[model samples]
Target: MANNKSAKKRILTNERNRLQNRFYKSSVRTLTKMFLNSLEIYKTTRTPENKEKVQNTLNSAYSLIDKATKKNVFHKNTAARKKSKLAAQFKTA
Candidate 1:
């Protein structure tokens, strides 16, 4: 428990930051899933429209992952790994 005023304030601030981080993290995951699903659809069709959708998915996924890394929610290496995997999936799709 926080006894001092400053400590109580710190606890509140931490809670707020935690919620914000959680939101960002969940959003990232959701975007990533959307990208993956788009890629899967692109795999079967291979039309220009599907390709454009795949590209957009890749771009959005990259942006969110990079943002998460920048905010320190994910490690730089972890982000790199994820980006690489996404790229590989895109290529094969």
Candidate 2:
């Protein structure tokens, strides 16, 4: 329990930030899953449609991660690593 006014405000702010961070994390995971699924479909089908979908998903995921890093939801190196891994997946596919 926060007895002081400032402490109460801090607690409220922390809750707000926590929610925002959770949203960012959940979105990133969802995007990553979508991208991976697209990769799998592309692997089996090898169609231009699948390639385009994969590219679009990758771009979206990359954009989100970079933005998250900038907003401090993710660390810079972590974002870089994720971006690198995603690019590698596309290349290998």
Candidate 3:
């Protein structure tokens, strides 16, 4: 247990930051999955609307990933690698 006032406050702050980090990480994963799913749909259907959806998904994923990196939830190169892999998936699909 935290015996001092500062230590208690630190514990609370850590919990808050942990929750915030969790949110950003979950957002990154959700956005990435959304992009991949949209890509799969585009592959199967090959329609303009599906293509547009895929593009939008990719854009949103990129934005969220960059935000996560900026927030220090992810490293810069890790973000770049993730973005590259996502784009690669899109290309191969």
Residue 16 lDDT in candidate 1? 86
Candidate 3 lDDT by residue in tens digits, 1-93: 999999999999999989989998899899988888888788889999999999999998899889989889899999999999998998888
**Which candidate order results from sorting by TM-score in descending order?**
2, 3, 1
lDDT of candidate 2 over 1-93, digit per residue (tens): 989999999999999999989988899999999999999999999989999999999999999998889889999999999999999999999
What's the best-to-worst order under lDDT? 2, 3, 1
Worst 10 residues of 3 by lDDT: 32-41
What local distance difference test score does each model get? 0.87, 0.95, 0.91
What TM-score would you give candidate 2 relative to the actual structure? 0.96
Task: Output the TM-score of candidate 1.
Answer: 0.90
Residue-wise lDDT of candidate 1 within 1-93, one digit each (tens)?
989999999999899889878977898788889988888888878899988988997898899889988888889999999899988887776
Instruction: List the candidate 2 regions with Cα displacement exceeding 4 Å.
Output: none
Task: Write down the TM-score of every candidate.
Answer: 0.90, 0.96, 0.93
Clash totals for all candidate models: 0, 0, 0
